[model samples]
Target: MESIKASLPDVIQQRIEDLVNAQTTDEEMAAHIKELGCRIAALEALAPEEKGEEAGQLGEAVHRLCERIRRDYVAIAYRQGLVDGMRMDKLAAEE
Candidate 1:
């Protein structure tokens, strides 16, 4: 695992540190993401339609941010699952 990680890019290393190492469960993350989406929608709703393209751009940018976060989380979950599976396999072998 260390060898595999060492070969990856520095950005991925940061992601593992920032996300995969977190103690949060998948459900908690999903809920948090849902909340963020709701907040985004609420903020967009508050923007005056008369303000025109700027408000739309802001909403689109925020939405993209959320989507990026969600995508990272999917990668995090997959890596975590792989680690969990490795642990289980090790335990089974020991038995």
Candidate 2:
């Protein structure tokens, strides 16, 4: 519990966890997650500058977070594409 909260601030982590545990469609969850990522990115960009090693650490953390978010977005897009393709195929078969 403390470790989880340490990794991410309590509020942010809790909100994300809530979204994950919610009874919602994958597309809806992905959209909300993307929105949350955008908000976090904006906040990071506006954060006050740090010095020396601290700045480097912050940069690394941001880089890793961006990569994770990008990967997740790609996965969501791929899944959505597959769903759309399947729907199209079904419609064509009915036609």
Query: Cα-based RMSD of the predictions, in order?
Result: 9.1, 16.8
Question: In candidate 2, which residue pairs get closer than 3 Å at backbone N, Cα or C atoms, i.e. clash?
Answer: none
TM-score against truth, every candidate:
0.45, 0.40
Off by over 4 Å in 2: 1-51, 93-95
Estimate every model's Cα lDDT from 0 to 1. Answer: 0.69, 0.62
Please provide, for model 1 over 5-39, each residue's C-alpha lDDT reduced to its tens digit, 9 standing for 90 to 100.
44345545665686676755778868877887787
**Regions of candidate 1 where Cα sits further than 4 Å from its true position:** 1-51, 93-95
Q: How many backbone clashes does candidate 1 have?
A: 0
